[model samples]
Target: MQSPIHETTELEELEEFVINFRMRRLKLGFSQTDVGSVVGKLYGKALSQPTISRFEVLNLSYYKMCYLQTLLQKWLEETEDSLKHSSDLTGFYPFTTYQPIERGRLSQRSFTRAFMHNPKPTSEEFGYLAERLGMEKKVVRIWFYNR
Candidate 1:
């Protein structure tokens, strides 16, 4: 069999895929009722025949694949298409982690200058900042606690 997909990110390719699937099923002489039976079995009757029709009309990728594979005797390229739309691989791929250098990136004078701008933070504020930084309040307490 030829590849199921011809191109990605193209509306034309998607339309053609749908048209061809429908046409081939027609060539096999399957009726909408037959499609609905399979759809009911595949997605359960809760989705129902009308729901299946709506999904097909909507070109809902997941629902289309579910309806097709069971209804039209096709493998359904849903997995491939879904993978194409998956999150950026960078999220899955590991990158070299870097840590900030000691002596900090800024001088103590600069740090004090910046830190002094904020109002005298309360124990509550220190606790919140500590939580945000994943450190104990005591760790940050020394920085803003002396107030």
Candidate 2:
């Protein structure tokens, strides 16, 4: 549970909290995008679905995880309270009306080959791969980033 940059009880607790958080979120019938829509309103900083997903999986930096935990902790409390007080929780939460972004499927074969050849592809290399894979350069970049 101890990340290299942050080896502390706090990190361990956060790691545990993240696992529980995801469970509770699913139990509450909330998707990552659903949480993302309202988490910002819980505090001031709005997080995207991808960001929330990263936080849940501990893919973020220790510092970023710490910050997001504070926000999500508050959100968890509010969401629970809403569930307790209302059968229709949507009335209590200000879930956004915006549509979720369409997720792009990557070409696994090409990406795997690219990764094996160069784990950290340069900007130009990323552009080339993106063109060959028919995906946005940013998507290709994020794929590598997540890896």
Candidate 3:
């Protein structure tokens, strides 16, 4: 079991941030899908609805959580600034939205083959694997990191 000290740690802070982010999102009349789309436009990477859902629930790894927190923080800052400067939210409309080319669990056969070849792939290898598997390199890297 976890201790009381653990409850007040950075993870707890992150949890609070996630809850606040959700509240702010809802107050701004945005859905998880809308956030996903906007985040893709704001940042280079596009998150899926499931990814955002998992982020809110803290189901992601600590590294991923931290990374996403940074992204979301930036997003919130920009969004708030837009709201302050503009009469409407139309200025924040995404010119291009990203949708994942592939969605679902990675194939066990391909994953096993890659794992056998190299338990820890380098950055280049991760990119290659991501392209081959139709997943983001970061997602592939996190998968290997979790393993």
Highest-scoring model, lDDT: 3
Local error of candidate 3 at residue 118 (angstroms): 54
The regions of model 2 sitting more than 4 angstroms off are: 1-6, 94-147
Q: Pick the winner on TM-score between candidates 1 and 3.
A: 3
Number of colliding residue pairs in each model: 0, 0, 0
State the C-alpha lDDT per candidate.
0.47, 0.77, 0.78
Q: Quick one: how many clashes does candidate 2 have?
A: 0
Task: Give the least accurate 10-residue stretch of model 3, judged by summed lDDT.
Answer: 96-105
lDDT at position 138, candidate 3: 93
lDDT at position 33, candidate 3: 72
In model 1, what lDDT does residue 34 have?
46
TM-score of each: 0.30, 0.58, 0.59
Per-residue alpha-carbon lDDT of model 3 for 1-147, expressed as tens digits? Answer: 778788559887998999999999877767687678678866878899999999999999999999999998898888888888985676566342222322343345677789889999999999888766645689888878887
Q: What's the CA RMSD for each of the models?
A: 20.9, 12.6, 12.3
Model 2, TM vs. native: 0.58
Candidate 1 positional error at 54, Å: 2.8
